[model samples]
Target: MINNTIVQELIHEIVKEEEGVPVVECLMEGSITDEEIAEKTHLKLNTVRKILYKLYDAGIASYKRSKDPETQWYTYTWKFESEKIEEIIKKRNQEIIENLREMLAFEENNMFFACKNGHYRYTFDEAAENNFRCPECQEELEYMDNSEIIQQLKRELSLYENNGSEIAFNFKSYS
Candidate 1:
C-alpha cells in the first residue's frame, strides 16, 4: 500500500487550498451554520456566504436552511461527502499507471545504436540517416542489444503491478 502519511498529506493539502476552507472544515466537522464557520475562520459573513454557495455548486459540500424565528433569515448549515475525494484520487492513480506503462514500452522496444569507440548512442533510424557512421569517430554504427533495457522495464512493471492495487486501496480508504 502507498504510505498513509503521503495520502493524508495530499488530501489535506488539496482540501486546505480549496476556495472555501471554512465551509469544508465545518462540513467535515458536521453540519455547521455559515455564521459559525465565518466566526471560526475569522472571515466576514458575506465572504463566508459566497464560499458556501461555491462549495454547494461544486457538489463537494451541501447545506440545509433553517428559518430563524427571531430574525426570519435562513441559517445555512453544511456537510462534506467523502466519496468525491476518493473519486479524484482514484482518477489520478489511474493516470499515473497509464503513463508508467507508456514509458516502459518506449524504453523496452524502441531500437537504439551506439558508437563503438565513443559513449554516444542513437536509434536505428538515426544511425541509418547518418549513413551508419559515428559523427565523432567516423566508425560504422551497429544495433545495440536491448535485453538489459527490456529487463529493467520488466522490473519496473513488476513493481508497479505489485504496488498499484495497494495504493489505490489506500486512497479509497482515505475517502
Candidate 2:
C-alpha cells in the first residue's frame, strides 16, 4: 500500500494545482467557520466564503451550522471526506491504465517502416498499401524494428501494475 505520506502529498498537490478555485487543505478536519478559515489561510472572510462555497458546490466538502447560545451567532466546523479522495485517485489511476494499454497495443501489434534517406517512419500497413515506398521521398521503405518500443512498453506496464496495486490498497486501508 502507498504510505499515508504519499497520499497526503498527492492531496496537497492536487488541491494546490486545481484550476479556478482554491482547494481547502483542511476539508477533513471538520466544519469550519468562514472566520476560522480566513484566520487559518490568511485570506479575507469574503474570500474564504467564496472558496468554501466553491468546494461545497464541487461536492468536495460539507458544512453544518452551530448556534452560539449566548450571542445567537452561527459557526461552522469542517472536515474532509476520505472517500472522495479515494474516488478521485481511483479515477486518475484508471485513466492512466487506459492510456498505457493503448500504448502497449500500438507497440506490440502495429508494424512500422522507415525511409532510408530521411529516416522518416510509417506504420507497416501504410508502407504496404503504398507499395513499400516512402510517400514523402518516393524511396523504398524498410521494416522498422519493434524491439525497443516493446521493451519500453513492458517496463511501463510493470510500473503501472505495481503502483496501481499500492495506491488501491492504500485507498482501501484509509477508507
Per-model TM-score versus the true fold = 0.54, 0.66
Clash number for each model: 0, 13
User: Per-residue lDDT for 96-127 in model 1, tens only?
Assistant: 66877887787676788889987588877788
lDDT of each: 0.69, 0.68
Q: Highest lDDT, which number?
A: 1
Score candidate 2 by lDDT: 0.68
Single out the weakest 10-residue window by summed lDDT for candidate 1.
Answer: 1-10
After superposition on all CA atoms, what RMSD does each candidate show versus the true structure?
6.0, 4.8
Give me the candidate number with maximum TM-score. 2
Of candidate 2, the 10-residue stretch with the lowest lDDT total is: 14-23
lDDT of 2 at 131: 96
